[model samples]
Each structure stands twice: as C-alpha cells, then as structure tokens.
Target chain A: MDSGKTTKEILKAKLAEGEPTPLYNPEALAKIKDNFAVWKETVVQEKDRKNWEVTPKTILGSDIPRSLLYTPIDNENLDYAKDLGFSGQEPFTRGLHANMYRGRTWTLRQLSAAGSPAEVNNRLKMLLERGATGTNLALDLATVQMFDSDEPESMGQVGTVGVPIDCVEDMEAIYKDIPIDQISASIVTHYPRNTSIIFPMYLVMAERRGIPWDKLPGSVQNDFIMESVVRSASEYIPPRDDFRVQCDNIEFIRKYVPRWNFITLNGYNLREWGTSGITEMAVAIANGVEILKDMGKRGYDPDWVGERLAFFWSPANDFFEEVARLRAVRRLWYRIMKYRFNCKNPRSMWSKCHVQTSGVSLMREEPMANVTRSAYHAMAAALGGAQSLHVDGYDEAFSIPSDVANLLALRTQQILEAETQITQVVDPLAGSFYVEALTNKIEALILDEIDEIEKMGGLVDVVDSGWLHNKASRYIQREQKMIEDGTIKIVARNYFRDPNLEMPEIWVKEYDPALAKAMMDKLARVRSQRNNEKADNTIKALIDACKKGGNVMAACVECARADVTVGEMRRAFVKAFGLWKTPIYA
Target chain B: MASKKKIRVLLAQFPLETHSRGIIAVAGMLRDAGMEVILMGNALPKQIVETAVQEYVDVIGISTYCGGELALGGDLMKAAEERGIKKRTSFLIGGIFPPKDIPKLKNIGFDGTFLSATKEEIVSCIQSAVAAKN
Candidate 1:
C-alpha cells in the first residue's frame, strides 16, 4: 500500500518470494498450435464441407470477430502478476474483493419511481419489503429537467415517468418514515445543473430528519456527459460552464457529504443512447479524467477524490462483451490511477460500478420475453463483478413498471443471488482463453478511443464541436439498420416472425390525471405559507454565486432551507449563465 | 414526363421529453427516401402545428417517449383542426406507447401509430399516407 511503489515494483514484491512460471511452456504452446491447425484442417474442414458450422464468426451484438475455438495459445502473452493480478490487489482485473460475492452479495437496487411523491414513497417501501437491499430513485421528467410540477412547460408530464419533486417538502414526502440514514439511495439527478439544484433538497431533508451529512450514504448522477452528449434536450448550458459546475458539486460534496458519492460517471445513459460498449467506457473515463484534472488544479488530493468516484454502466445483450468490458475497464482504471495520477490507495484504484440492464435492449413485442432478456443481462452484470445491479422491468418498454413487473424485476436479482451458485467463486470466467483475450482486446480498444478523445481536445471540445453528436447519430442509424435488415436478430422483432403469438395481459401503470391539479395546489400552499423575503434573498445569493463562479451548492443548500422550488433555482441559473443550444439540435 | 413533388414531413417532440434516437433515425430514413424532413426540436403542440402549416408539410409526425401521449397528441390534433389543415396533413405518432393507447391515438385523429417499427415499415407507411393525401 506504499504510495511510491510502481506497478512493476509491486508485482516484483508480490512475486519475489516465489516467482510463478507460465503454465504453458514454449513447447507446449507449439504443440497446441500444431494440434489446433491439424484439427482445423481435418475435423473443421470436414465439417465445413458438410456446412455444419456451429460457432458464430463474431461476438453477438458487436463487430469483434471470434475464433471457432480458443486455447492456451490465445493467452500465451498474458502476464499473470501484471495483467491478471490477484483479486483485491494492484491492477485488479479479476475482482475487487478476494472473496467476491461470497463475502458480500451485490446490492439489489431497483430504480423505482412514478406518480406523486407519496406514491413513489409507498413503492419504495414496498420494494424494500419485497427484498431490495438499496433504493435507486428515478425522478420525473419535470424534476429532472428542472421544472416545477405546476409550470406550464411541465404540463401532462408532471409525475409520468418518475416521482415529482418540487421542493424540500416533496423530498421529505418521498422518504417519509423511511430511514435514509440506514439504507443507501441513488438520486438520479442526472445532469450537473439539476444536481446542484435538486441534491441540496435531499440534504436539507436529511438535516430536518436529524441525520448528519456524513451518516447519509448515497450517490448522485452529477455527470456532465448526460448534459453534453446523451441529453436530448434542445437547450443546455455551455459544456465548459457545466463542467465547472460539475467540479463545484464534487468539491462541495467531498467536503460536506463525506460518505456520499458526488458523481456516478454515467455511461449507462450514453450506451442506451445507441453507442457501442467501447465508446461508453471511453467517454466516461475521459470525463473522469477531466474532472480529476480540474480538482487537482483546485488542490485536492487524487486519492481522496478518486476513492469516491464510481461508474454506472448499461449491460446490453452482448453477454461476454459486457462482462469483458467491465473487467477491462477496471484494469484500465487501475493503471490510470496508479501511473497517470500516481495514486497508491488500493481503494482509489478500484473501479466500483453499479450496472443497470439495458432498457433499450428490451422490446415491446412479446414483452414477457423481456423478462428473460433482463435476467440474462443481470446475470452478466453479476458475472462481471458489479457492486450493485438494477434489472429493467419487463414492461418498461411501454411505461414505468407496474407493481407486478417491479416485483418481478427485484425477484430476478434475488433468484440469481439465492439459487445460482455462480457467485461462489471470484471471477469464475477469469482463466477462460476466450474471456482473457476479449478483455485484452477491449482494453486496447478503449485506450485507443481515450487517446483519440484526448487528441480531439477532450470530452468538452468533442461535444461542443458536435463530433460526439455525429458519432452517436451514426451508431444509432447503423444499429437500427442492422435490426431492420436482420443482421442483428431480436426474437419477435426481426428474426422469427410470429404473427399468431398471443399478447399477454400486461398491466401498464396509468398516468394520474389529477396529479397536475394536486401538485399545483400544493405549490400554492407552500408559496403562501413560507417566508417570501427569506426565499427571495436566498435566490439572489444563489444567482450571485453562479455569476461569481463560486460553489453554487452551498448557496443551494441555503435555498433549500428557505423552501425555494426546483424551478426557481433553475431559473436563477438560467438568469445568471443563460443557455446554450445543444449542438445536436443546432 | 414531369418530376413529382417531394413529400415534406415535420417531426416534433416536446421540450421536456428527452428521447430522440427514434425521431432522429426516422428523419434520416425519410430524408433518404427523397422526402424533405424538418426536425422541430422541442416544441409545444401549438408551435408544432404552426411550423407544420408554415412549412407546408404533407405529414406531421410526433415522437413521444416520456409519457403525456394522450394530452399532447390530442392538443396537436386540435391545433391542426383549428388551423383547418387536418385533411391536408397526415398525422402520425411513434415511440413507446401501450397497445391499448393506440386506439386513443387514432381516436385523436392520428393517421398512424407505430411501435417498434422497422425503417422500411415507417418509410412505406409515410409514403402511402402522403400518397393517399395527394
């Protein structure tokens, strides 16, 4: 754990007592290669003559080619101590912990939210009672986009997708009678601007509940990627300003909320926006690097900031590719932290992640099949050594999950944890020739992409210049074309044309028509009863802080105490910094 | 032999609705099919109809992912009706919607409702709808 030891030095120290030799010697590798060549010409050629090809030419859902079979010849160049180190050690490519899931099971966190705040609260309690170990909060579009529920622009969309949080009162209602201090929560504030505005309300609610800030353990998706690259909004703050605000949120959270993860580098939404898995990690890593450099400039310790940095990934249909990408990113991150940033803490080197099954992979046709698809995706996440997981509901392709669908999604994770013995060993797929080779290939590709992004002037420049938009557009179009031409086969969608399949009786969550009026009335009550002068003064201070390039989160916490609404804080930001047209729409 | 006029289409979504992959792909397909595609980024129902009328588009397509399909779609149809362009403009709705809600969209005068549709299906549907209108 010395801060000055290089990876090579650490490897030498770890292996000095008994240096391990390669399992396959040169003669053994040559013999395997010769036998493989002979088998290819004899048995494989014979099978090829009969057109009995069984193995796929490429990995599913990706362009990476795969061989018919793999052996020790594939991983002959892999170094055990450096490339595939022991779990819980330097260059952690296998698993974060030596015991892996045997020591502690991955957190079963379901992303549940819909209807009013009280309704979402009830659903959260129900999920906890049904066996979810953690809570992942999904905010309504109105709340996420920084509009109050009663605003004209928020009409008909108040509580449709997730919970509507207008003020601290809404936050209190959402976590009413729930011990947030005990159970961790993930507030999906998503973009930096919203995080600055909305996360303060959560802190204020915690304060009101007499829970200290350090005692509250949770994460916020305060990612600039959501604002710059994956966002579909037509308007945005400039990427540079958003990045600054992102660093501001990090600085404030690291100082005040010690146990809280200030930012979850959000690759999940980016992948769901139609990029490949390689681009997803590369983009997120590039963003993380930018934030680290900014915080370093602000004179913060890399190890201190790096330990709390976490990632959120979307596990898509490519099972092996997803698992390999996870392993590859962990190793790549360890190298980045150790060599590039010179961080010596093993915790700082750990690439902790929470994965959500890809919502885009689920199909609306024969929705029940989505259950199977998500289960497979969740299993891949577990095999990839995720710290937490969220299985997309079978009915999410249509709307927010119905109660039955939510329960089923939670049960999917529970079944995997209890019934399957897959988690008994650490990194069960570590020694596979195919997996190791794939991990190396993916790691190299991601590093190359990161280098390309750096050459293009980092993430902010690429986004501002519309290069990221063009890349995403091309990927989206190509994916849709493949699905259309049957190159990528989805069960009932493009592959097996089933015309007579009976549609199951799916219960979709209905939108509450009365929600708009009720929210409007509640806002009216809050406005009429609160101290208007205090709220106005806090709003002025927040706007001043925004204009002065100061930490806006502190001012936002003050605003939250004054009961300032989400929309009010957002308007103040817009008033101070204005808005930039998103390059995609521009 | 005279050249046929290219079909003009306008695709719009609500400002708060943040799912654009479907609409962007559909726009690309329509453009490739020799149709003039106008992307109205994040507009209200009234603004969408006004832009459709101003652009003289033959079709108006609304892509909604986050909820509020009924309210927004109904308002869009009403706006078009008020402008007296319902018959001239073929209206279509696409994106994630419950199967039961398809009838409601049709009831609101949406000429077509597509869910999980292929590019070929969307292009041909728009072609036929515009051809019928002509």
Candidate 2:
C-alpha cells in the first residue's frame, strides 16, 4: 500500500533505454510454452483423455488453443512490484489509490430516463435523497441528437429514453433548487456538437444562479471517435466535424472549468454493441493516445490534456475477464501516457474511471434473477477498483427502471459499501494465480489489438476504413449464434423454457404521455417569451464560428441564453458545416 | 428462381435517430448468409418504404428500442401499402421491445418478429420471407 515509484525513478531507467520493455519476463514466457507443450501431449495424447469442448465467452483464446489449468508457470513472467507497483504509483494496475475504498467510497450514481425537465429534476432529488452522490444524466435520443421534442423527426420518441432539454430554460428546470455546484453531474452524451450544447447550458445555469463556471462539476462523454468506431452513433454526424468539436470543447473546459472532468470515453455502450472488453478498452485507449498526439500538434502539452480525461467501462458477466480487463486498462494507459507521450505531470498517468454493470447481460424473462446478476457485477467492479459504479435496474430489459427497482439497484451498491468487508483490503484479487495470469493475458491482448489499430493508421483511420464497424458486427453475429446453439446461456430466455412460469409485474410505471406534451409546450413558451433578435444574432455568430473553424462554445452559450432551441442550433451547424451523408438503404 | 436470385434485404432503424448498433450487426448476419444487405443507417419510415419499392428488395428489417416502434412500424407498413408493394415485400422488426407492444407489432402486418432474434433465426426468417415473397 505504499507509493513505491517516483516518476523520475521509473521514467529515468526506462525512458533512457529507447522503447520500454514488455512487462513480463521473456525467458519465463518461453518456459511456459515448453511446459504447456508437454502437458498437452502427455495428459491428453498419451492417456487418450478427451477434454470437453469448452467455448470461451471472452475475446482471447476463443477458437485458438487454451490450457485448462493455469498455474505459477503461466504467471512466472509477472513481476508484482515492477509491473504493478503500488496502487497509488505509476502503472496503476491495482487502482489509483493505495487504500482505495477504505479511504473514500466511490460516488453512487444512478441513470435517469426521458421526461420533462421538472420531472427529471424530481427523479434526481429522489436519487440524492436516497444516498446517491452523482447524477448520471441520460439524455433522450431527441436531446442527444439535438432535435426538439416537436420536430417531426422526433415525434414518437420525445422524452422516451431520457430527459428532453430543448434550451437553457429546460436545462435549468432539470436542476431547479438542487444545489448545482455541490455534487457531480455526468452529462451522458456522445455527439461532440450536441455535448457542447449541454456545457453552455450548464455554465449559463450557474451564471444565473450566482455560481462561477469554474465551480460546475462533472464529466462529459465527448469522444465521438469511439462513437464512430465502436458505438455506431458517430454515423449521426461527420467524423471530422465531431472530432473538431471535441478538441474545441476540451480546450474551453480546461481553461474555465478547472474542477470538471472535461472528457471521457465510455466503452460500456460499445460492449452492448458486441465488441469484447479488451477490444473496447484498447480502442478507447487508442482514441486517447490519438488525442494526446493531436494535443502535441496543437502546441498543448500532454500533461494538461491527460489531467482532464477519464474513462468508463462495463463490468460484464465474465467475472474474471472483467476484473482482469479493469486492471489491465490502468496499466496500459499508464505506460502509454508516460513512456509514449512523455506526460510530465504524475496526475496524467492515472486512469480515472467508473464501471456500469452490463445492461445487455440483463434478461427480460426473469427480472428477479437480474438483481443477483447486478450485485455480482457491482462486486466485480468494486474488487477490480472502479472509481464509481452504476448498477443496472432489475427491470431494465423491459422498460426504464421503476422507482422500486432503481432503489434496489442503489441498495446493491450500498450493501457492498457498508455490510461487506471487501473494502477493507486493496486489490484483494491481485496475486491470485488465475487472476494474475489472466490480467497479463488481457494486457497482452489489448497491446496486440492496439498494435493492429496503429498499423492501420490510427483509431480515426480504422473508423474511416469501416473496419471497426465490421469487426463489431462480426463479433455480435457470432455471439447471437452461440447463444442460439446453447454455447452461451441466458436464464429463462434461452435455457430454462419454463412454460408454466408466469412473468411477474415488472413495469411499475410507464412513461407518462403528458410529460412529452408538456416538454413541447414548455419549449414553445420559452421561444415565445425570450429575446428573438438576440437568438437570431447569436445563432448567426455560431454559424460564423463553425464556418471559420473557431471555438463554438461561447456562441452556443449566448444562443442558449436567448432561448434558441436545440433544433435551430442544429440547422446553424448544418448551414456552416453541411449535413452528413447519411447511409442509404439501397 | 428466388433462391437463385441472392435475396436482397434492406436493414435500418425506425427513422428516429438512434444508435446504429443493433441494425449494423443484423446487416452483417444477412450479408454473411448470402443476402444482399442494404444498410440505411437511420432512415424514416417513408424513406424505408420508398427504398423497399425502389430497390425491389425482398425484405425490410427495422429495429427500435421501445414505444416508438409501435407507431414507426405502423407508419412503414402504411407507407408500403400506399405504394402497392406491401404484399411483395416482407417486413420484420427487432429490439428489446416490451411484451405489450408485441401484439401491436403483429397488428401492423410485419411478416416476422425478431425481438432479440439469434443468427439462425434471423437467417431462417429472411429465407422464409424471401420464399414467401416468391
């Protein structure tokens, strides 16, 4: 639990000797190959023992050969002190802090669904009252896409998936009377331009409430490259335009909002899209590395850029793999930030992140069973040392979580925090033979994937080549087939087939139809009431900024204050940067 | 003749600007199974129906998350009917839709339901739909 390595100490020896050596011992790895050969030949070939055909759910070692029992031989190459260091030190394989949860508990964040701003505010208040420390705002599709509730394209889906915020007033209504600057508020959005919309609204909201813009807290998921590569949401706008907005917003936040976590790459959603944990993490890191390189080109140091960055991942049903993946990403990012990018500040090497339990792992058939599944995911995330966590509601597969279900999800985390003694020790699973070996394997897999991506130019190029999309699609297709063929199993849906089982009442409350209407009416009223000339003028300035390739955040703030709705801003952006050629069916 | 003709299927999201994750995967599955897959990223119901008529596609597969599909699926079918190609084209939908909405999807005249359908089921449905179209 000591802060073992100084940046000077680790950086001096390694950075002096050109490229950094691999974390594992080369001689020991060669010996493992020898041992594995004999074990496979003698145990299986000589004894005529047929090992069961086991299919792996993880990315690595699927179709390729794998040993049934891993041992000290497999982990002989691993160096605990050298590779892992102490938890608080460089190459933070264990965690960012030495004592971890014993020193401070992770922020308890719960996701919100679509509603009127007032309705969503009530939900946030209820969540805060229930011991939640962070508000992970989930914007409706219309809002995320920067469409107004009344837009013809957004008709049926308004306020369905998340809260619909049309302008500054709507955003102000969402946090009404809740102390805006005190708690963390993570704006969960993807499209870079749309995400920039919320930043101005948050700043303007604070300005009106007599709070400084610097006091506003929380992170934004502004990595549109990841959206393009893995999440498939990048198809909403041109990749080049998205990347430009990302750099502009991050630069703005770094200058003004010093306390805010300016940017994050949420790979959890991509896991649902069918990419494996290691692949997704590798892609996320590759995207981060590309950002570091871009910052260098723009005369910004890697130190300041890395300081404002965070990551988000999913802890899936594959318990050991998920644990290993969490451990591996930290180590990999550390190596990349320090050795590759030469980030001088020690804070830049640390990978700060939260883990969300995989919603795709939840099944609609047996809603009660999901409660247990979510608990285990939370436990895995905690043990693996996530900075924060969001447990999926038991009824998530059916609809937006009911109040009872959301409360129970919070209880799952609280029990882990209070009743369990898992928080007592740091990295409890650190030295387990299987876990250590698996962690090394995951690291190796991620490095290999990163190498492949680099060889294909970079993350942006990989996305442009359309390779990442095809890769994810292939993995998803294989996964669906495996489940169908009984290679992978879900409880009641695929395996149980309980004909007489009656599904329990899952939907405690359906989304109110009146709320969507109310949101539209509020948008109309705000437009009618606010300064039209100011809105028109500010929008033109925003369009000029976009055309001149200038930072558009300030212009956006002025527009927001003038009650320019999201829909109008969308047109201004289109007029300046042109519309993306949406993929055609034919 | 239809079996010999490499059946073309148009894949899309139900005209609301949702993420392209679900539809992208199914497009891969259909393409791998020897069907010509046209990925319409995120086209509206009318755009989907027009593409079905214009391309002379044998199948139209769309996915939605919840609630919206009930109306959008109905819109697609209605648009297809107005174009007089509703009978010739097979309509299918998929997503983590609520059970209550399943009946409404059926009422909208979709040829097949693919709520979380597996690879084999998707391929088999596409094949069956193409054969039915023939």
Candidate 3:
C-alpha cells in the first residue's frame, strides 16, 4: 500500500463504515496536515537550541508526555471489528473474557502481611470477609527473599512487613482451617527458594487436603528478565546460566500444574521506576516474547504456554492516560500473538493483568488525601478493565497500614465495585473518540520504544548497560526537581496549608512472644525430626542440577520433601550462583 | 533583621513500603523553610544510620509507607543509641505511624511522631525538634 493509495483506500473504508475520514474534510485535514508539515519544515529550517546547529529533540521513553493530545481525526480509519474489536474477539483490545465484568467483577486483591503467620492469617481472613476476592501475601524480607529469619543481615526485621514463614509447618499453621482450593492465594516471592521451598509446600498442602491439582487457582510471578536486566551485568550468574534456571522452571511448570500461572511478566515494577508507558509496554511484550522464544526452542508449544502467561502493570496517576495504556497493551498483544507467534488460540491472544496504583503519586502531606488519590486510580483501573486490582492504602505513605487504614483501602475498592455501579459493564470507556485516539498514539509510542530497545539488543541489553537504571534515575531527578521547585503543586504539600487536622493514628502489630517461642520450638523439633540423609542428598542433587544445566524444580521438589528450609535452598544457590550486586552510582 | 537559623534537617525517603509520596512532600516542606534537606532514597537501616552520621544534621527523619516501619524504626533507633548519637539528634517519623503505639515510639527514643504530618506541620515539627535539641 503506497501512501497516496493507502490514504484514499482507508478513507473510503472509513466513510463506508459511517465515519468521518480526515481526507473527506480537506480544510480540517489540511490544518492537521499543515501543522505537521510546518513542524517538519521548521525543524529542518532552523538551528538547534544549544551550542551546535541542526538537532532534533529526542523523546526518551521518559520524555514522552504522560497523556497524549488526541482527536477524532486520529481514529478516522478505525474499524470497530478490526481495530476496536468486541470484548471477546480477535485482537481483543476491549477485553479477554467473553462477558468481562458483566460475568464477574475483577478480584479486589489487597496487599496484606503481619508479624506472624497467625496474625497474617487473621488479617487475610479479615480482608476476605470484607469482600476481597484473593489474599495478596507479602512475606517478611528476611524469610521470603533472603530465606533466613535470624540472619544478622536481617536483624530488626520480622513479621512487621509480612508474615514470617520459616518452614512448611509455618505455612500450614498460617492457612490452618482455611479452604485453600476455594479461594485464589497470591504470593510475592522472587528468591531461589520459590522453586525449592515455597512451590512444593503448597503442593504438599493440596495433596494432603485431597484437593484436585486442577482446582488450584493462583498466580506465581517468577520473572528472570530482570536477572538479565539487573543481575547478569553484575556477574551474579553467567547470563547463560540464569537463562538455564529460568527456562528450567518454565519447562517444569509447563508439564505439570497446567492450571497454575507460573510467570507474570512484572512490567509494573519497571513502570514504577519511572519508565514511560510506551517503554513499559515495549519491554513487557519484548520480555514475554523472549521467554516464549526460549521455551519454544526447548520444545514447549506456544499454544499451551500462552494459557499460563499473564501480565502485571502499574496504573499511574494519569487517569485517562492509564486507561489508554491498558487498551494499547491488549491491542498490541493481540497483534503480536496473531502475526508474530502464529498462535491460533484466542486465549493466547488474551491480555490479562493486575494493577497496583502508583505508589509514587501518594503524598505524605494530608496523608488522608491519598484515600482520594487511590480511589480515582482504582476507578481508572476498573475503567481500564483490569482482571485484578490493588488500591494503595491511604496510610501507605506512612507505616504499614493500621487496621483502620487497611480497612479503608479495602473500602475504596468496595465503594467502586458496590456503590459506584461502575462494574456493571466491561470496557466502560469503550467507543470514546478521545480514548481511541489516545490508545493509537500510545500504541505508536510503545512501538517506537520497543524498536529502540530492540536496536540496543532488547530489554536484557538495556538493563546490563545500566541504560534502564540511568533512565530511571534521570526521570526521578526531574520529578524531584519539579516537586521541590513548586512547579507541580501538591496540595497540602507545596500549596495550601492545613495545620489543625491531626494525623490519624495506626495500630502497629507487635511481635507476639508466644508465636515466636512456638516458632523457635517448632524449628528445633523439625530440625531434629527431619531425615538428615534425605536433606543432604537433595541439597547435593540441587547443586548438581545447577552444574549440569538440568531442571532444578524437580530437585527443588525433593528438597521440600526432605523438609529443607527456604533458607537452606537460598544458601545453596548463593554458594553456587552468587549474590546480585547493583551498580555503584557515584 | 535577624535571619532565622536554618533547621539544617536531613530527610530520608526510605521505602519501608513502596510509597514515596509522603517523603517527597515532606522534603519539599523542609526545603521551603530554608532547611538543608538531604534525600536518602530507599536506604536500609544501616545505610540510614551511616548517612545520619555522615550528614551531621540537627535532625534525622525517616519515612516508611510500607509496613516495615516498626522493625525498621526499632533497629534504627537502637543503632543510634549504641552510637551515643540519640541524645545529640532528634528523630521524627512520618507516613502511617499508628497512634495507638505513639507511646511505643516515644519509649523507643523517637523525640516526636508525625503520624501523617502535612508539609507545613512537618516543617514546624522539624523547627521545634531542632530547637529542643539545641
């Protein structure tokens, strides 16, 4: 399709579809066209702003504006069926599910944790009882990520941030009496222990409870894209070796636990680090493609693997901008699946995601104002058609959420789901001329960023060269300067003064002496009772798998069988893989 | 006309949780008051103590939006006390400080608590903390 012929042909299609094409209205088209033409002319005709001449302003992913200015003329050629398709159709830009929210509302997954497993269990029940669809578990930093509750490096840390789970017994004690199969449980753990300690503990619970394996519905977000992005360059593990470990899990999960979602591409963290929406989308799609490509070469079919794929994205403070982002993600993913991968299944084309509101946008000033901030962002996510949503607690800017603060955060989502009547339909913002235009603009911008990253050798390259980190640091610097200089006025922050309203108080969960004593005693008993021979053999097997480039999850399962703690598995990896050292910024 | 003595405050925007909004605003407030506010973004407790010692400021403030404050705060204060630095500096906390345990923080050696202090209140609190320390 030549430019001239394509324009004319697209115009005819638009008019036939009962739409106003920019070409038909010559005067209006000339205005927009002329503006662009003049912009190009001026760029070519004039000297640059700085020391030298002939420069074009570059749009770093961060330099791209948060919200694009779009118009109806932008979508003149958009076909409802081809472009903005139905909720459950090819290129599902609208939604993934057939009925969408009309069938059921998105899961209200609140981030919850406490000092002890029992406390977290109580909190989980409280959130579930208050209309939360799933339990979002945040593990204690020492226990979950590093794997040792009593490591000197982990001093002064306990269940304050998340529940402390030291053994299979702790996991069992935490979920005692709760129907695990009935509800979805979401856990956030990214250490070596996930394959070894965590995954098997849950399997054991399922097997013991007589629950069918297919009935287990939950999300395990194990992403290694960042290992290439953040760790590989630091020589934490040789790039090839990291790939081996990641591919091992993907292969293991593919064959077993067909119903479970193994890896959720966590583009949300990248977005939180100040990457632009387009960069986020570009990296996300590229990351997913990399994982799929590697797995396919390993003989796993894309058809089976795509069903297990999911995404997690951050919904920023820009309300309509976020809606446009989600729309662009769905549209672009559908295209990639259809054209790039040649996957025939519609589910392969589906883009399902979970959104957590922008933590950067929350203000410490008038901390109560965050309630309103989260409420609006939650609405944006709802309108954007998120599969699951977590609204930041109003007190999130302060400490761990007091019970009242956490309850209020839950209520924020409840109000949207129950009182607002916004959940009555799926794709609530569909058919908006402005929204469609924004979606197209976002799609274009994302493609440009993806192209730039591809040129740099993809997401892994950008991460290794410290380019992504530099980009984030530069963006954060600009935002900080703006907020500091009062260029962007934050209410109760740089602007208005409210001195009299006392900050609301929160109740911090304390370390329970009884629980700690019970844990220590339990730890001692497990140490004495578990078969030492079995544990030693499993550790050796895990190490051998690493050296042989074999699937580690199988060895991980054996480790769990021997009651090897999460900490022990972590130590084994550290011994072999080494710790990730971040770049030192001077 | 006598110029007001600058509070010379150091603000640590620690990510106890994921939220940075509160510290960003509070830092701005302190800066507006002619205080030399240093932003230590997402530092661990040890790094925070090291920064506090290096900066040699009149006051040290830490913010946590994540629920790790109690554990973070207790260790931070303990570190300060061990260094014999607790008496010389005033520590103020912002973000979601539960009111029920304000006494606990006080007992742990935080001079005053800003449960969710606005920028203005935060600045004022810094001024008073600096004065009390002097």
Tens digits of per-residue lDDT for model 3, B32-104: 6678877665566667777788888778887754444666788888888877777888898865645676688
* Of 1 and 3, the candidate ranking higher by lDDT: 1
The candidate that achieves the highest lDDT relative to the unseen native structure: 1
The ten-residue window of minimal lDDT in model 3 chain A covers A52-61
TM-score of each: 0.93, 0.89, 0.78
Which ten contiguous residues of candidate 2 chain A have the minimum total lDDT? A1-10
Q: lDDT, candidate 3, residue A143?
A: 60
In order, what are the TM-scores of chain A for the candidates? 0.92, 0.89, 0.84
DockQ of each: 0.60, 0.42, 0.16
Q: Rate the local accuracy (lDDT) of all candidates.
A: 0.84, 0.76, 0.67
Predicted candidate 2 versus true structure: per-residue lDDT over A1-586, tens digit per residue: 0123332234345645644445557787788778877877777664343552343654221232245666677666455565778888877898899889989988777786557778889988887897777787888877777778887677677777788888888778888888878988888866578767777888888888899988888888888754455433322456667677777788788888888887787677666666788777878887787777777777788998898799988887878777888898888788878777777887898888878898878886768899998998899999889988889999877677887888899899999999998999998898787788888778777777887887777777777666776677678767766666777767887778677766564563334567778877887788888888888999999999888977877788888888788889878887887666433321
Query: Please, what are the lDDT tens digits per residue for candidate 3 over residues A1-586?
Result: 1122221233334335544323226577558777855654666433422322221111112333322234445566666676776788866788877688778788777777776777777877876786666777877655645445554434444565777777677777677777778788777755323544577777666766788767877767666654434211212443445555666776776677666777778787666655666677777787777677777777777777887788888776667778888988898777766655667888887888988887666766678888888888888888888998888877665555676777798788889988999878878888787788778778777766666776777566666566765665555455655655666567776668465645544345554546555556666788789998888888888888877776788887777778777767766765666655444321
lDDT of 1 at B91: 90
Q: For model 2, how big is the CA root-mean-square deviation?
A: 4.8
Ranking by lDDT: 1, 2, 3
Give the share of true interchain contacts found in each model. Answer: 0.63, 0.38, 0.21
TM-score leader: 1
**Candidate 3: regions farther than 4 A off:** A1-70, A122-133, A190-196, A210-212, A225-244, A400-403, A406-411, A418-428, A499-502, B1-134
